[model samples]
Target chain A: MKTIEIKHLWKEYGDNIVLEDLNLSVKAGEFVTLVGTSGCGKTTFLKLLLGIETVTRGKILLDDEPLVDEPDATRGIVFQRYSSFPHLNVVENVMLGEEFESSPLFGRSFGKKRQAIRERAIKILKRVGLGDAIDKYPSELSGGMQQRLAIAQALIKNPSILLLDEPFGALDPGIRADMHELILDIWKETKLTIFMITHDLKEGFHLGTRLLVFDKRRHDPDQPNRYGATITYDIPVEKTDNETLDEITGSMSNKKQEATL
Target chain B: MKRLINQHPRRIGKILLGLIPFLLILGVYSFASNERLEINPNDKLMPAFSTMADSMHRMMFEPSKRSGEYLFWTDTSSSLKRLGLGVAISAFISLVVGIFLGIIPKIRAGVAPLITAVSLIPPLAILPILFIIFGLGEVSKVMLIVLGITPFLIRDTQLRVMELPEEQIIKAQTLGANSWQVITRVVLPQILPKLIDALRLSLGSAWLFLIAAEAISSTSGLGYRIFLVRRYLSMDVILPYVVWIAILAFAADYLLRRLSRSAFPWQITATREAK
Candidate 1:
């Protein structure tokens, strides 16, 4: 069964339409990477998947049921920046999800429950290679380490679906490579269905089981925001990466010219 | 350094440079006081340091014959109590109201403009109204302080809450945090240091409101004592009281700084990054 299903999903902000006529579905544990030009509504797509943004029309279903209107434990997200809270230390950041689940009112746990969360948090931190920096704050960590902490935070709740918005776009090339390896390792270990948005097409090809290209198929010369972006290309992964990358590049350039027209 | 902006004063240089203005003010005051005292021994406008010291000693150490209370200590306590209650209440309300205003868009849209309008109103213009409503008692004095600073604090707090990155809130929610849990867990810890910062900024205004309220109506406060001694033009008592108030404000500011620093070490780097 498909874990996620989007049927003619559209999003609009007043007169400005941001996404439209989108149809996609994902089987369980699929790594789907989305790429698009700026203002083409890739972040909006992530926000929609995250349940932070509402759909203007159409519907998104999770596991054959309608996705909840608000964000819940079933879906977790990591942003490029501010994925980890600056005020919380690494372990505390990881522990907060469970605490929210345990104690909804105070967002706190006492004695045994708190201890269990702490232990689980430390274990996840070790898994993410942040054991050495458990006591350190988000501000103290490097870009890669902070992203690792963020991933750990997302992972702690053991959500079935994880949304990543260019989680490595801000990192240096060297650090980005390390994050790629780390995320891949986690994906292999867990059955997490991830929808990651990336600026880098090569990274998208390398990481995702399916690559989604979001671009506005129709545009109005008079009103730039008349129509929103649709998933113009949803390519399943091939064994060879370079050929597919070149194919996407050729189509992207052709698509850009059409968008101008 | 060639440019003032590039100049970083060494520790000793900073201390000595800081002393220059104080030393200059002291030299000017001492000269003026000594000159006036020499010319007219009964000069109440510019009392000598020794005379101020004697008055402070009598007020601080000895019980008054009529009241059987150390006037300096009594005044200090009453004034501090009022200031503390007013500021505490203001901060408590600011936090509760500001968080709700900042996090929830519906509440913010409904009430933010009203608060802005309230903040814009001159607090001193309504001082007599507060006195009339609450009467010329301790309640009026405290209410005046609360009214004077709470609006500023609430607005500051709301602004700080808005300044927090949206991703953090989303992350909290995605992790299954309820609305209140998101506030208590994510918003509260981060906003507190900023509130402490806002409080530090509001201290001068709080003291001003307290003193004005106390001077106008109260019988036992630092402001009351300072104004009461003005009939005989008691410069000695007034100068010492002024200095004492300055010392208290400085100590309070220092204590707040230390409290935020020790309790929230993460805030330093976070704020630095924000800058």
Candidate 2:
């Protein structure tokens, strides 16, 4: 069964079309990674899925039900920057989802329910390797630690789908590797349907069960913005070995390769 | 030692450097007062420090002979009450209005121009209008303060809200926060420190309106006392009142700074790193 399905989706801003006639179906518990060059509509696709940007045409279905125009608890997102509230500490940040769920008006819960929420938040933080830094603020944490807190914040609500937009883009290589392992472990444990966008082809190939490449196949010299980018390459990596992946990459690049990526 | 001083001045040296300007002003004032006294022993202008001190003691400690009320304390309490009421009301109103204007594009488009136009009007020019409408009472004075500062506060808060990263708002919503919940939980907490900063900046203008309104008409206030003593050339009372006003303003600013540091420690850390 598909967890998310997009049919004939089109996104445009004024005369500029960013995504055109795109269709995607993501099954439950699939780790999907998208790779593209800058301004190739990769981030726009994520925004459309997160409901931050509305589609110009067509519909998106979540668990066979039409998704609403606004964001909901079923979908969680982590951005490259500003992934966590700087004012809240690690524990408070992780607990924020449950707090909002319990008391939508006050953004807080009280009594025994609040204690349970805190304990859950702490357990999640521990899983994310942030138990010692629960009392620290985002500004006090290193870049890697902050990303971990953000992941905990997103995962605490047990969202069915997690969207990450270049979440490890700012971390060092060592930290990025650690984050990759952490994210993979989480995906394995929770069986979440995750959609991640990355500029690094190796990272995209290494993590995801399915890989999607976005690029504008048809280009006109006179009217550059006439057509939007579509998914030019969709490679299933779950069953393909490293040698087979190279053979697939060679054939895919020959079919519709763009100069940028 | 010289190299060390050039690289970074010691704490004691920095303190002495800061005090130099104050000491210079004091010395120049004392010299001017002595010169004036030599010409006229009964001179009311630039009264001696001792003379000013005596007047302060009388106004602050002793009750009025006719009314049996400590004028200084009564004036302070009344002025503080008006100032506090005006600031608190305007802050609450501006917060609600500013957030709405910032988050909702339609409301922002409709009301932003009106607020900008109102803010452009010099608050002092409306002093007579406020007095005539609200009458020569505490209401008028407090209203004047609110009118003077609310627009600026609203604009500041709106800008702060707009400057927030779009990702944060989206993240909040995806985390199951409805519109109101996103505002209260995410937007409100982020902008509170900024609001305190806006209030701190508005206090200067708030004091200006308060004194101007009080000078026009008021039964009891620090501004009223200052203007009352001005006609008699009571330099002793006037100078002391000016110094007292300065002290009060400093205390208020200090208290606000301390409050922001304690209430929002994360903001402080962020600012420190930014610096």
State which candidate has the highest TM-score: 1
Instruction: For candidate 2, state the interface root-mean-square deviation in angstroms to 1 decimal.
Output: 1.0
lDDT of each: 0.90, 0.88
Write one digit per residue (lDDT tens) for candidate 1, span A129-235: 99999998899899899999999999998899999999998899999999999998999899789999998898988886888988888877678889888998888
Best by lDDT: 1
What are the runs in model 1 whose C-alpha is more than 4 Å off?
Answer: A220-222, A239-243, A254-261, B1-7, B272-275
TM-score of 2: 0.93
* DockQ for candidate 2, C-alpha atoms: 0.76
lDDT of 1 by residue, B1-275 (tens): 38988889999999999999999999999999899888999999999899999999999999999999999999999999999999999999999999999999999999999999999988889999988999999999999889999999999999999988998988998888888998998899988888999999999999999999888898899999999999989999999899999999999999999998999899888778668
Model 2 C-alpha lDDT per residue in residues A88-128, reported as the tens digit of each score: 88899988899998996798999999999999999999999
What does fnat come to for each candidate?
0.90, 0.85
